[model samples]
Target: MSHVRVAIPKKGFERFEKYNPENLKSFEQLIEEQNGDTYCLKLNMHLLRMYNAYPQLVNLKITRLILLKALSKLPYQHFNFARKYLIWSQLIDDGIRVIIDMADLLENEDYEEFWMHYKQKATILPILDGFDEAIRKYICFKVGSTRTTVPCMEFKMKLAVDKEVLMKYITQLGWMINGNEVKVFPLMLNDSNDRDVIRGIICSDIR
Candidate 1:
């Protein structure tokens, strides 16, 4: 795996692989990966609260593993180049495809497989784009029609929660553009790694 060259911060991954998940620092890095800039997408804190509140979704760590994927369509406007962990989906399926896929991946605490899947820089964007479309379609047909005040009303109702409490948190992180204009276009390539922010300080001797 060392020679495989994962896109993650090498030193931080070393700690993650070595230290206990219960160890505060290792746990913090995991938390960072969930909500931090390592990946362009982030978890919806509100959806996470919902997942936590439901016993069926409890104890699976599904919130941590799947919530970010649920919100993968969001944009990340940072400039770090070494690690292009942009998670976008282009697929057109409803939600079933991704939900089943995510469930299979997390079924047995398959962290290594998940890590390997995410370390790729090439496919994250397309996968996210696909997942985004899937979510919209699934929420519409299987859950509710887009004509409703809330598109995914049926899906939310399945959770047995009030629409008010199921407050959404996705639009907060999307691209912002007024009049579809751009004021600046900075052009420069950076070879530096975003590992420090993502995985914390890197150690010269990770061994």
Candidate 2:
């Protein structure tokens, strides 16, 4: 009599055990060395596959690291790299897709919409340490470099922060809060070309 071989799928917890400390250490090393490298793109995809299959098995620390790296490249990469990686991995759902959507809004300078979306995804905040701060810094830099002064109300809306919280960032930036306006920089009553030059100078200071 011929017998047919049957395969049994491993239990979820059993699969989870396979991602031991040793494996995690090795994975972290690879991520550290290949950050921003093209080869790392494939490595990220592999991670996404595991996350999609058994999110409970994959560590949130690892997920946060990869997602933050992707976010850091925004506006510059325009999230094309992130989109491609997610598409190839077929894991563009849930928090992952939400982050990419946020990146899109930031790239387009749609601050109000981005904040609204961010609030809706507050549940994902635990895995996104420093995300709001990073975005706020980016927006502050953009606004500071481009404009000498911005209305406090408008600035607060752009940052999605209350007046008190906005004051903290303004103080840290060495900007003055005058009446209803935040002075981002000294008034440069110059032509557009001169303003562009001043903007370049201000941007260089951050770099």
Top candidate (TM-score): 2
TM-score of 1: 0.21
Candidate 2 has an lDDT of: 0.61
lDDT of 2 at 153: 95
lDDT of 1 by residue, 18-41 (tens): 332233233333434553333432
Whole-model Cα lDDT per candidate? 0.32, 0.61
Please list the residue runs of candidate 1 whose C-alpha ends up more than 4 Å from where it truly belongs after superposition.
1-10, 15-21, 24-58, 62-67, 70-98, 101-207
- List the candidates' TM-scores in order: 0.21, 0.56
Q: lDDT tens digits, residues 1-207, model 2?
A: 433322222221234433343344455555545433332433444454445545455654455457656575433342354354343233434666677677778878899999999799867643444567768877887787689889999999999999889989998888998889988963222356434543543453345
